[model samples]
Target: MSQGRTTEGVRDQRAELAEANHVLVDQGILDGFGHVSVRSAEDPDTFLLARNLAPGLVQPEDVQVFTLQGETDDPRKPYLERYIHSEIYRARPDVRAVVHSHSPAVIPFGVSTVPLRPILHMAGFLAPRVPVFEARDTLGSGSDLLVGTAASGAALAEVLGDAAVVLMRGHGFTSVATSIPEVVYRAVYTGVNARVQAEALRLGECTYLSDEEAAATVATNTPQIGRAWQYWRDRTA
Candidate 1:
């Protein structure tokens, strides 16, 4: 767990985070509003996320550090839903990275009764169930549905539990992993899985991977995530 928090190490992490922003944009997993963040290697109590800017355009200088309590002194305004990252990190010590996106293909499943399932081997993480967080249930009906406060964010994190991903009803979804690349991989594939599942439902009955099959596939696929990360990283480059 040594972060090598030398000046070079910090710079390298910033660059990787910036690259992740662009990579998510290239994969269409994030638009102008979504964001990605990584727990600070130098300070586990803090994390790195870009200031309020489009993911594709985030630069190293734009990346700002913030405490896990969601406090930051950066001159630029942070994303309103930054609590999504903060509270999740607070709740899950194993999670090192998080990606919150309004990915178009995945939105329908969040707002509808259709559950997003692992229709393909690449998305075995969706096997059990993608928990849906209904904001109204926690924040009241008139609320904005954004994880804008620490309390609301904590509620969402609770719903996420040990799951790798959680769907926010009428909003989007959040994906968490042990590394930035892995989280990006999960976020992108989750969107892909959603699209494929939607299409399968259109034709007729769709067969999903059973829990055992999904668990096996997930075990096998976990280590190969770097391949997709490299592909997406190169695309952004």
Candidate 2:
């Protein structure tokens, strides 16, 4: 691509993601513990994320900068869970953005031993498997529930494969894509699927689309991307 993420673009993305954070909170996708980050539009080696604060309370100035490699520790301003964003962006080149949230319904499936497959029309894109990471919610004591380290990040990137999303077992979800709207859209659909899967699981066995059907559904659902972006944009208005 053009790498056209100018200072203006990054600023705009920061504002948009900031606005998205509030909307996400309004929609119950996030509270104070969750986060959203985007690769810096002006600097490829860095990313922009809000410091650990209530998503809905964030302002444009609340966004801070961080090195992509995660080596430096600037104490002035920092995100409590920067690794989730830094690691994902550093590891997954295809992922331009990532959203980490402890969404209610989705959190159940995260702790579920079984994979959270898509059982609804919206989730057909994630049928069969959604790259569920089988790690425990807590490692030992107080360690953060993330891939841990660049090596682990690379492992997660590999395990995530070419899929657009991944769920940490016993933790939460990381919906990733090339745009903020795409990531947000995936996060929304994921929660919806969690609700559907819960209901379907209640009624004994539930029918799900075959692998081929899932692939076809993704191809056919391309246009919904714009619609989803528009709908969410209007939601907070």
Predicted candidate 2 versus true structure: per-residue lDDT over 37-64, tens digit per residue: 8787676678778876778888877888
Model 2: clashing residue pairs? 5-41
| lDDT of each residue in 38-86, candidate 1, tens digit only | 9988889999999999998999999999998888999899999899999
Superposed Cα deviation of residue 78, candidate 1 (Å): 0.9
* Alpha-carbon RMSD of each model: 1.7, 3.2
TM per candidate: 0.96, 0.85
Q: Look at candidate 1 and tell me the lDDT of residue 22.
A: 95
* Model 2, runs deviating above 4 Å: 1-5, 71-76, 136-155
Compare the candidates by lDDT and give the number of the best one: 1
